[model samples]
Target chain A: MEQQNELSFDTLVIGGGIAGSEAAINLANLNYKVILVEKDLSLGGKMIHLSKVFPTLDCAACITTPKVSETIRHPNITIYTYSEVKNIVKVSEKKFTATLVKKPRYVNEDLCTGCQECEDKCPVVVKDQFQYDLVGRKAVYVPFSIANPRVVNIDIENCILCGLCEKVCPVDAIDFTQEDVEIPLTVKSVIIATGFELFDPTQILRYGFGKFKNVVTAMQMERQLVPTRPYNSVLRPKDGKMPDNIAYILCTGSRDETVGNPICSQICCMYSVKQAQLLLGALPMADVSIYCMDIRAFGKGFCEFYQQAVGMGVEFHKGRVAKITEKENGNLILRYEDIEEGKIKEVEHDLVVLSIGVLPNPDAKLLFDSPVIESDEFNYVKQTDELLCPPDTNIKGVFVAGTSSGPMDIPDSILSAGAASACSANYIRN
Target chain B: METKKIKTIDIIKEKRTVSAEAKQNLKEYNKIKKLILKSLESEAKTIPQIAAETELPLDVVTFYLMTLRRYGSIETGEIDDMDEYFSYKLKK
Candidate 1:
């Protein structure tokens, strides 16, 4: 209890995604005592799933790994991976006490050296959740190559009741008996950097995502296209065939009231183009079509990059997709009214990639002392307009950043992360 | 010993906070009289420059500038770096 009560920091960050990861690192660099609490076992968030970043096409892992590494190594940062915030209380004015639920990894993280030998010996195999169920890994396995803390975890339910790991433990690190622990942390402020969740195409029903193997979400495609990704290459999961034509449906759940998110996701169009580039690069002969309403490249060099994507033989359809059907030969058939031709047309392709929209993460609504400010139905935080009397929220020191504000790309997320850092600093910066 | 060269941490020793001062104003116009006079002595700073000085996100800087202008505390003078930014100098 003393250990729990003794732990306190200047800031508590919920969600270890790009926004929280970056926000925690930024705050720690500013010399603020920080506790970065992530519900998942790893950081990096959706940014990790991305194969290549937009505008620059830099390797997503290459850029995100350093930030992950920095967050883990920063002296001021206390990272609680595989932990969830259970309660938040304002004990004093402008201060927050947060109770966190830390799920058991079932292995002694302090003693385990991340040696995968135990995983190799384990007889159980489970679907790698991080891979979108595209691949299988041992029940006791590291989530990814770059998971922060770089430690392995055991899937207790899937374990084959084998005691071989315990017999061969050099450090006695394997602990199947460890129970779930609750950690309480107090801080001056809290930042809800909980990133967005993917919109399920099953909501639209016309896409038939769960039934169609050829049809995939843009996130699934990213996992496939990323070289370091579990599968290592792109192929149809249905028949294991490398198809040459892929059609991308942009704004699948974005800008549609029936699907619930009507606001522009703001980043779908660019990521769609980037995925098109990756597809073209992977399979040079692949013919690609992007059914998009508009291409917004508002940032610096974004428009030019979009133009270059156009030059690279990716067709830009200025219309919405009406429907997609699975063909006999495991091909995806896209049927939509070409706004340009004013006629309904159908095209057959090996894969149909849904550029899904981003919405507020479900876990963002955890803080009890300070409430998350809502600007849109999508839950992007609203900002006060007047300069001198700008409207910050009920939370004294906490601020919003990245896609938590709306659907923004890496550059925009980075910009918001910086802004939140600045405004949060005004309260305690001196 | 080095003289405190032009105290960069320059702050007013006014007895009232900004909110308190606003409450004590004789009239809406008369109330902002000091703020107007104070803004006259400020100068505008660009977005990047402000980010460099304040170490904040560009969006926050632009956002805060907008708020300051609306409150008659700051004003925008020019566009640089392909985005419009404001100077920190007080608005008259």
Candidate 2:
């Protein structure tokens, strides 16, 4: 057994996503020591995978990469990617002890260059999760081109024990002997910025997500619009055909009691609209339509963005998609109820994108040992003083941020993170 | 150096446990990979053309071709003007 490592910090941020990264940077800038732990292999979270952010249409990676770089270079911030917080014990009002488990990447961070030699030599091929499995990756791969730390991880489950990656490595960084290391840390305050999970569209059999090859999640369509797109263009996944008619179904699992997530996923409307606009530009002749119960353009300049999409020939149909059936040619027949006309309608599209909603990631609550952090009926972290301080968790010195509390867009998530960091700093001072 | 490499392989074999399902998957993937490479040996072809030649599903052929493309085993050529499928060829 390896010797356990112990560290102490002023604050511990549970996620390395946008909110968590912002909070960590804020505290670090304030001369307070902060540790950021992320479960994935990289610092940039789901935001990095997006093509362009809503409203501004700014490149998503352009926004995330600099923040990730800043977070990495900050003197007062420590990051633990490919790690999870197992348990957090509140020792005192001003102090908490957290136990983290760091999973091995099988490549030494110090020696391995971001070179693709090992990835090229490896014989095994598996689904690339970063590309949403639209493409395949090698057994040993860097998660994505812009992954923070830009290191490769060995998928031991898929690796064939072929030793090809080990042999081909210029730095000999592959270390199969590496094991999971337990890290114990003492922090003065804790911030729960762990993010939300995308509602799986596969759960809705009526949408025909997995059953219909042309039907994809909104994230999958977003991936095709990026520079690192898998297909090089937004094409039908079934046959690689250029889609002539594309349909976006908003609120796939949101604002529906049957799906058990009744609250609106605030960002879906704008993101789907953004994708529709991008698709229209990419395939100029293709017709793009968005079917939604209603367009909830709530944020600043959001209504203008919606109107811009409408002006750009994005057909906005006020309707709720009931079910989808696939033709032999992989075209999807959407059966929907027209809310404006109060009539049932059916339409065919070459490709369909399901605008899935956000659901609360309840994994963060399990880390607490005493006075378990309370979550709402929907499993979002219960904001005890949402009106006064939206970040205040029930437990003193513990705060919540981002979609860990509820579904929010990027701007609101950042605001929530700022509030959480402010509340944490105030608690530590007092 | 060869002896040291063999020893490391032995260590991996001892330490790692490969499941039956995983082994079966590897075997299947290798077989499919060989078939796809063989079909692309003579000339560049689109995914549908490869699928037709190999008598495999379009998704399966696309998955392997994309993987090969990413890893530099294959390269994509111009799109077919008729059907819009990109022509793939074994990398020289």
Candidate 3:
């Protein structure tokens, strides 16, 4: 362990996602010193991975990139990427000291010029988790092209000692001698915007998500549609063939008692419809269908989008997919119960996407031990009043925002983050 | 506090030794890589064609093809109009 470094800030934000970034920027604009900690090498979270936002179908990166840049360049904000909040101890009503562990990136942040020389020369190739493991990335590479603090991180686990990256570096930025350091931060208030994780559909044995290559998650489909997509176009992973008939199975891991998550993951219905619309435009001759228990197009302009998808000839079936099996030619067979027709029917599609639900990030609980930040039955941070004080956690100076509180869309998440920032700012002022 | 400096190459060498499980995995990976290279030797072939000829799973073939493509061992030739799959040829 290296010598612990002590720093003080007006606020400490636990995540570097859209919500946390928004909160940090808002507080920084208010002339408050804020420290933002992220568990990944990059600042942008799930939003960066998305193709586009709902209803308006605006580019997701377009909305996130500016915020990430602003947060990174903000003078009042200090970002600690690839760091974790190990413990938080409350000393006073409005003061808390947090122990953070900053993992080594193996490259000196000040020396790296964000060039791709090291990445180009590195011979070790591993699955790129940013692309949902659909493609390969060099062992020494940045998280993405537009990543804030565009510095290369050496994947120490997979890196071979070939030293090609070091030899080819123009500025000699590659360094493997770095070790993890402990950072102690004292802050007046805390904001929890740690985002949600997608439910792993592989637990549902019948869905065959991992077993069948053609059956992918909704996020994987989003990756296929993004501008920085893994492939040239959307193709089935099993054979890299353009799929003519694609099926979307809604509520794969949500609203199911068996999976222990019974809440309706509020964004799945709209996103599935959005993806169906995008797929129709991308592959005009192909047939796109969505199987769901119900169409909950409850957001503003969302019902209109659903209607627009219907008008575009996208098929919407009111059914629950029972099982999915792969065919001999890498196609998928979907067995679903047709509630409208009152019969169980089988449909075949070249590709299938499982609209998995959201769950609270399991790390939120592990970050704090002092005030015992209470969480609801669903593991979302418990709010004093779900209607009134939505961002107020049991801890006095601590606030929860975004999907960390519950399931919400991008817009709602931004609003919740705004609320959290207001709450933290108010606490810091008084 | 007195601190000693260490070479990056020394640290990298210390961490690069493969475990038994990793050794087995590397062996399997090389075997699949060789099969893929052999399949693309005669002519350019699509992922499905290579998978069928080599009697390997399509996902396994796809993973190795991606690895080989990253290593500059394979290059995409053309998209087959019939199935819309890209043909990959071994790099000369």
Best by lDDT: 2
Model 2 lDDT per residue over A1-430, tens place:
3548699999999999999999999999999999999999999789989999989999999999999999999999999999889678888888899888989888898899979899988777778999888888888999999999899999989888888888888888888888889988899999998999999988899998887888999999998999988875677777777788999999989999998989998999999999999998999988999999889998999999999999999999999898999988788999998988899999999999999999988787788987788888889999998899899888999999898999999989999999999988999989
> What's the CA RMSD of model 2 in angstroms?
1.7
Report lDDT (CA) for all predictions: 0.70, 0.89, 0.88
* iRMSD (1 decimal) for each model: 29.2, 1.9, 2.7
In terms of docking quality, model 1 is incorrect
What TM value does the first chain of each candidate achieve? 0.93, 0.99, 0.99
Highest-DockQ candidate: 2
Comparing 1 with 3 on TM-score, the higher-scoring candidate is 3
In model 3, which residue pairs have backbone atoms overlapping below 3 Å? none
A98-162, model 1: which lDDT tens digit per residue? 78777878678999888777766654444567877655566678888767787888765555444
TM-score of chain B alone in model 3: 0.79
lDDT, candidate 3, B38-64, per-residue tens:
999999999889999999988878877
What does candidate 2 score on TM? 0.97
Using lDDT as the measure, what is the rank order of every candidate, best first?
A: 2, 3, 1
Worst 10 residues of 3 chain B by lDDT: B18-27
**Superposed Cα deviation of residue A247, candidate 3 (Å):** 0.3
Select the stronger candidate by DockQ from 1 and 2.
2
The TM-score of predicted model 1 comes to 0.78
Query: Which portions of model 3 show Cα errors greater than 4 Å?
Result: B1-6, B12-16, B21-38, B67-75, B90-92
List the candidates ranked by DockQ, beginning with the highest: 2, 3, 1
